[model samples]
Target chain A: MTNSEIMTIHQALFIVMALAVLGSAIFVVTTSNLFRAALMLILTFFGIAGLFVLLDIGLFAVAQVLIYIGAISILIIFAVMLTRGMQGMVPRNSQAVAAAVTAGIIFAVLLLLFGPFRVTVDVARWPVFSLFAGNASPRDVGGIAWTPPNQPIPAMPETYIADFGRSLVDGNQYLLPFLLIAFLVDVVLAGAIFIARQRRPAEIIEDRRRQAEEAAEEAEAMRQAGMTPDVAPLPEGAVASTAEH
Target chain B: MDLINDLLKIIGDFIAGIINSIFGFSPFLADLVTMGLAAVMLCTFAALSFMGLTYVERKVVARIQDRVGPNQAGPFGLLQPIADGIKMFTKEDTTPATADRWVYNLAPLVIAVFALTTYAVLPFAPGVVGTNLNVGVFYIIAMGSGSIVAIIMAGWGSNNKYALLGAFRTVAQLVGYEVPMLLNVLPVVMITGSLSLVDIINQQTTLNGNPGIPFIVFFPFSALVFLISGIAETGRSPFDLLEAESEIVAGFHVEYSGMKFALFFLGEYVNALAVAFVFSTLFLGGYAGPVLPPYIWLMLKAAVVFFIFMWLRGTLPRVRVDQMHNLNWKFFVPVSIVHLVVVMALMKLFVTSPALAQANGGVLVTPGAQAAILFVASLLILIGSLAVVARRARILRLQEAAVLEQRRAENIAAVSA
Candidate 1:
């Protein structure tokens, strides 16, 4: 494609992606059900990944997917189920509304401040087309582009080797923060445990009792129907050894 | 439209030229670049292979206790992990039957991904970083917390008592240590005056007349806090209640096996390596040492720290869960904050203050006199604090022993009656 045509395609992609991102973000905030909100948030992440792609940060796009879609989205859904707060009829909480409004105002302020300056879209006209041609995967573009000018682009072999060597000892630059983040992960883990432990014992007991009653009722209904109750196996080492037998 | 096209062409041509000129005409250069890209690809794929960590732990623990771990596998247990991998993949990957599958699956992957991705921003060698983010330090801290959600999910989703309990403990430990770790880093940041990893290293690159004052020596108390917190953060021995195998089993990864389990394992080792890497870089002056390639020195530094981790694992028993929390909240947190303040003040006085720099033989090549003075004062402070703590502890122990003796006498009297 000619440079102008490439530019147009890029611009179109960005606009579409941006709109999708905005729409998903809106849905994420506006959805009455927490589960649906979490789903919408996933969509928003995907949209942001697209924007990263548009910015020629393919590495970042993949990372966004690897971390957000692969990890964070799952986390949100897990949290929803654990609290069981996402269940039942959709109630629009005033707090959620306030949060949405606050977010909207901040977004509006940001747009007013930075939206006037146009983003340059010439990056699309680069030999990015060649990158996609001949079955060249998106993952290869980073290493081939690292060399000095006028060299033939190298073809990286398919080796799933991550470089942990240079990050530590590269004298000109250090990977201190990367290392520190690992510690931070530990700290965050500690904090999460502390918070989870704060749940009152009474609340826990009540929740368990309610769940047990529901299970017994389900089993009784199945017996009346002249059918074996299809129950999941009990976890190992528990008083509920009936499932094992 | 023509003018815009002309501008675009100029920019495009300039970029293309830069790319071409740098690469040269050699396919070898292309091969090298491809190799670099391949390394990143490996990291992504290796992230998937992180499940081996669990297998490794199982086997290692077994061997340590005079038993073969997973010996039933393909050969002296080499292919045991592979077998386990297949088992996990084929077995019904149930979502606790009633648990949150999305979060359940996502938690392991999240932990694995964040653990791996942090490597991207690290400078592997000079000019060899995956992404060289400007705010590398802050980004690491912010993104590091992203994994908390995943661990929480695992705990809540498993719908099992043990799983939930383990997850709760893991999260608490992770969060509690974060404050001290960040606070410990502040002094280094103060000395460097930038959160960029490159800038921090640059500040400490010299020995006699190199990068400046090794930030560690400049702020020894900060270094100690960073070291102490770093150890706590890794959940190593004396702090590793998270996965206390005898107690919590595998903790958050208790139910995980195969590739899923591997991700958690890899996350852990990678985390261990990453933590050691940071500790070495910040306090040991990164890759800066005499008579060695910078990268080699950096690795050696990290290796030393990693060995220390292993040594602690081997030598020290795990602290009780309550003690772990108390240590972080009661001791490390306050100490870290104070260290940051003290070091910041020191940096301001030494590096930034022109008069102080002049008195100490200039900023870059300051005499040992200033450092020696700071060292002596710190030594005195440390000794005083140690003395106070020892004295208090001795009195408390004596009082506790007396109380214990009284209780023993009461027990004997009851038995006689």
Candidate 2:
């Protein structure tokens, strides 16, 4: 960090990206427009990816972009659009203070846990993460040797991704959580399809007939009121425009 | 090996010398100037190539459709792209009355920036690249994916139904095809055991002085899937559901005009070029050929791949939206996943050890034998998947026929009554 210049390039980039991430995060929540919020969420994701790049972990940086910005944000935008009555003015609520306080608390917790300040409160416990071991010796995590506390963290090996990949399918290491996540995704997809399942032909016919009767009744009411009874369902196969603008 | 022989390296060193010695600047200042110069060079290269690519595409597509393309411009349309650029630059830039101003203005720039960022990790030749990030391939994919956000922004900002619909299809197309695209890339990464493009290229043949088999010979199916998915990713024909001119009327960019619209065009061609370069690097042994400079070889390879892209665009008709989704989900995604898994498993089994592979010599089987085995494996998987696809088609045809027959019977009965 020490340099004759005002700041090192890495420090400058880190500050810029951190500000971007934080600013976009606040904008995402504070903005009333759901679409704009989704876009801002993408910027937040991108800035976090920038932070990961600054940390020189290209894998996490790309993963952040690939998964969060690529997939999740798109999904969020889709949800925002598909739900009716959302694109209009969203009423402002009185929860800004609560949200800010909660966010600050989470940020503080994250900083204490794994921030770049390098002052992790539970650094020793994080490797094997055992409370019952009585601090005798640190157990290695996935066969990776643990660095003792109060020394600089060693540079990660080049093949860390390969090691991580191997552990995902290994007999012991992340196989359980990985499988659980896969199963959860499977269930979620199935649940989504079930929720959006089409109605049966009989149900559709009954609904159409009921709508026709309702329209006829409305027409009669309009006629009794001495106005033209022009209100009726449009022809089938017509699209109802739901454009936001 | 020396700067004198490597033209790019020499030019780079010259820039550094001028910045450091001639200017007597601090190291940091010199570095900054060097970076600025490099960025300028890369941008100039990108802009020129983009112009050239647009001209080439029109000419090729025009010839494909039996038309003389752009002959009215300078020297058989050599300067047509420049003319087109001027036209685009001068075109009236109009904003929708109710459009989201900032998002509308920024989307094109963002997409263009994202597209340009992909070149940073691409290796043009040995020791000649923007940055050569360790996770180069992944980084490129991530950068390319950022365009989805720009596209979404364009759609939402336009305040037009067509634009919004285009954005919707973008999500369906890009997100769906990305699975197969990543899976297609997995075989190359698994074979090389590296995400770095240079490493992948070196793994193909050019590692050390020995010439080896290009990965395409080993994973031809992966190459095919990658090209198809790459085209889908680029929003080109047969998978261009995002635009679907007949339906969405130019899709997300319907409202864009002038240079802003041209930026989207730039993003597209740049993306297509990136995909081609990536394909050549992944499969065609980038910069690894006999009797040519490495970057020239890489360019030739990329040009061939790019021509294939143009050829496919000329030959194929846009698929129906349902067909696009079906092709991605029911066919490409599952097939690519299986292909990746099989390749990974077989490669793992055949290669003796990572330590041996790393040593660059020891292996249970020679590279030739491994390539043969991989080729056979890929052929088997390809054939099996195609057969399954055929069976599915037959079943769907029968089901469709049954429905048509039932409808006909109902109609006949009603008429008789």
Candidate 3:
């Protein structure tokens, strides 16, 4: 195939993938069945992962599959199953109009900001983009041969993963953000555990409080009786409260 | 044997050469063809492995229980899996009356596809990887995780209460185990300073006169943690609460039948195989062995690990749901965290101290030194943690005894009255 032909193929594939993503995303929100909606969301995630692969960001693609499709989607499905009345007709609300208006405004703003740019201009500026167009040598665009500005570029490592690791940990790059993310993740984990733990029910708390009050009253009555307190019989409530304590 | 070590690479190159010759003028077509071929090959390998594993597991488990297994089929049950496949293909498929039709139909396919896709990053031999992904290990974990969604789908779409309960357990158990599993993996990545499985294997090779040392020797505790968590991740026996037969009736797949059920079975075995492959790749020195083909060595290691899994299934009883959670949260998670800290600290010490580095020939500490340090540290931590747990158990027992005694005394007083 010629350069233009290859570009056409790629463009076609990209369009199909984009359609799949958008279609699934729309289905996710529109689907009445909660379970089906979760499944649609998973399809959306898979489409996004495919896009990541096309972008040559393989790590993010896999992470997307692992986290979004694997963990989060499962949790969503689990929640859907656990909740009763999921299959019931959803109540119609006026908030849908408001949500649609807000979404439309956001979409319009984004389009005005970025949609008008020409692909030709991007290709001209980054010329590396033309490699995807199949008009340029991939070595210059995809290979680890690009030089950094202001410094003699060193030989590239065997894989970019090492560079990615360094960029995260190196003091001059993303080190602070990386540390912040680690801390934030720990906080989130602790918060999740705190939130998910089984809490004492209000009824149980009320019952315990009533039992304690009854026990205190019984103890006071026994003292008031004052007829050899050591030998005096304790009430059932007092015995239960004492056992609990 | 040496030729066998390069066999996959040789075959790959030969095929590439042919494709290049045919589509010499079009790199795009050439690349496309190559990728398609690789995908087909990977899928075939996964499918074949799944079939072989089923037979192997049945025969092995049967032997463990001192019974003849599948001998009526061709050649010691070699043909049994084929028969089972035929039966599954011809069986009447059913969808539950109340099932969400689309999700119910798609769940098994999703699982099988995801399970096969995980092989894309696994390196079978030197220069014989599907893709030399930079984030290879992470990608594997990620792909493995995708199956959890499928499990949930299977459970929910079945519209069965038992299936839903199984799905809940799947999420709770599998997701819970991932933390410690990833934690255990971190130390290996720390030592190698790379996430690529190939790089990790290369670091352990006996190339350039350096000793080839498996990480298992240096970080046995971490390896144990990884293995245990891995078994749980695969939802295999003893940790197979997701499909506990007596309690939940095959768990999420109870409502499935025919080829859909077969797909789930295939996915499960493939996942088990994937876990074994990863365990061998990360900690068993991958394809590195003396005087044997690299791929063969890798297969041997994986087989041994799979056998161990089967052995464990036969030997250990399934733990209760509460006990499984306690094992993950109270024991594995804390120990994994502590192990990560110790590894990081030792790594820092090795990097900063020139004397220590020099003593180990300018790499991280020699494998022997590393083994000694990690072993001693893990031993101390294990003993200390065990002591604490023992003390807590004793205290709880004593408290129960006291409560019983008080209740008995109260009962005697009431009787006297």
Candidate 4:
């Protein structure tokens, strides 16, 4: 099929992304397991990324996929897994209710805001350049290319498309917002660090003590066993120690 | 109004005209040409710059340390980058047995793409952008954010704790710094009233004759904020906590070897250049100089910032992560916000004033009562919110003190018993 035809065909399947988001959201709320919830939330982020692509903000789409899906999602999943006593995390009813209410509000707001905005751009009207043909294809030729009599045309920008590097970082319209965001992020970082520190000081102290003790034990063991103290195999010996425990 | 409508009509017609020109004969052919050109440009720039940047960074760093860098390879180590490239090519490509092969391979490609892709909307010279796409700055911000994800993928895909730790530090640092970096630019946007980089540069040139009041020079506080935040954004010293060699063992790319490692290195330098270039342009009267061509001036500006980055690498000690966040939150963010307000006020008082506006080659910013009123109201709102929070905190503190006193008495009685 020609590029236009493919985009047209894929247009309908775009709803699949929406469905995935819905499914993931449900999973996030309903799943009792914390890890499962985090995983589902990651899927939900992916779905949102897909929606960003559909919205014509390809940069935002990539970012959503990369940041929310790739980095933030992983960090969250790590945090969830790292949380002590995370097993048997029952899905809370209040969380479910909050999620439901939030979703309803978002849907209602979207419907109310965008329902009347008539979008005139049609699937057929979108500029879809066929690549296989050595020349620009006419409408008739495009039709032939999509359901070719024999030879297929090359792909268009839309088909194997990636909009790279369209954003400028120095525009006046963005300068203040950029600075503000930097400042805001700084605040968040400080707050996160402070909270993390405050909550985990005991854990931090314990962790350090354990590590120091382990190191000392390894050194003493190495000396006692007549192994070179300089080449202390603490990392290797830790595995054996854990096995013994 | 008629002129604007006519201009808009003409622009629409021009686009329609171009579409018509390429509409017939088989659109596939046109696609091939466009895509082919894009690919060629992308590869050529990325490949050439990657090599050049590697050599430049090493030599520059070496010089900063009062040592000869790569002089053995052809004329002041001009061919060193080439030698390094060849070395990478000849090295035995190895992947860890425990690594996720697909992700491990994909990590470098994603990093390189994210780095190179940032150049798309950057204007090297007037009317010489890759594509003057709308919302260009926003796109860069978004793409830059994507790079963090790629870093995480690299870290995770490597299956090494050091790499994971590095990636975690990086993600936290980048995400954390991005806010102030963005905040510092808001005043510029407010003043210029356009998102286009070209428009901003053009605006700068228009202020050529003005003394000590170049758009960027005028907003000294914002400029400093942008530069500092830009340095942090690019993960340069003293903010290079993520990839501290002694700390996280080269951070996320610890497991990557051979060409993959090379790609990460290349991505980093290019990313630095990109940030420096953008930062220079945004806050330093980009490409604005006398006794040089405009493009030359642009290059000079970028080079100056690049030098500063290198100098920073040599001179400044890397800040601890806690200090980095503290600097960002307690100082940078609030100060930047206040700076923005001060600038906005200055703009209102000077640029908006009919008398002084014309003096600095600026269009008179007509003082609107609505804008002034809104500004005042927002300021008041912010103050009110702070007051409420402070009161609540005070009450909580008092309650805590009372509880502590009661506990002290109970403890004394227990001791006596």
Candidate 2 global CA lDDT score? 0.82
Error of 1 at B127 (Å): 1.8
C-alpha DockQ for predicted model 4: 0.11
Which segments of model 2 are wrong by more than 4 Å? A1-7, A84-98, A104-154, A167-173, A193-245, B1-5, B207-210, B352-363, B398-417
lDDT by residue for model 3 (B1-417), tens: 556679999999999999989999888889899989988998899899889988888888888999887888898879999999999999999998888687789899999988998898889989988888888888888877888888888887787878878888998998899888899899889878788999899977852257787888767878888899999999999899999999999899999999999999999999999999999999999999898899999999999999999999878899999989998999989987987898777766555235757775444655566656766776676677779888988998999999999999999999999
In angstroms, how far off is B291's CA in candidate 1? 3.7
Candidate with better lDDT, 3 vs 4: 3
lDDT of 4 by residue, A1-245 (tens): 38675565456557899899999898887866554576568669878877876666655675676568645776775675345332233223346777778888978645533454323332355434222222443222222222324544443344122223222244644556777898999999889867655434565456556776888888888889988677554464464444332
Q: Give the per-residue lDDT digits (tens) of candidate 1, residues A73-98.
A: 76666566566543333334346878
Output the lDDT of residue B152, model 2: 90
User: Which digits, one per residue and each the tens of the lDDT, describe model 2 over residues B1-417?
Assistant: 444336776777777788888556467777777778877788778888999998899999999999888898878879888889889988999999888899999999999999998888778777778887778888888887889999999998898889988988888888888888888888888778799998898887743344768888999899998899899998988778788889999999999999999999999999999999999999999888877777788889999999999998899999998898888888988888788888877787677455766765545766677888989999899999999899999999999999999999999999999
**Looking at model 4, what is the TM-score of chain A?**
0.50
Candidate 3 TM-score versus the reference? 0.81
Q: Which residue pairs collide, candidate 2?
A: none
Q: Each model's RMSD to truth, in Å?
A: 16.9, 7.4, 9.6, 16.8
Candidate 1 vs candidate 4, DockQ winner: 4
| TM-score of each model, paired residue for residue | 0.61, 0.83, 0.81, 0.60
Instruction: Give the backbone clash total of model 1.
Output: 48
- What value does the lDDT take at residue B346 in candidate 4? 58
Worst 10 residues of 1 chain B by lDDT: B1-10
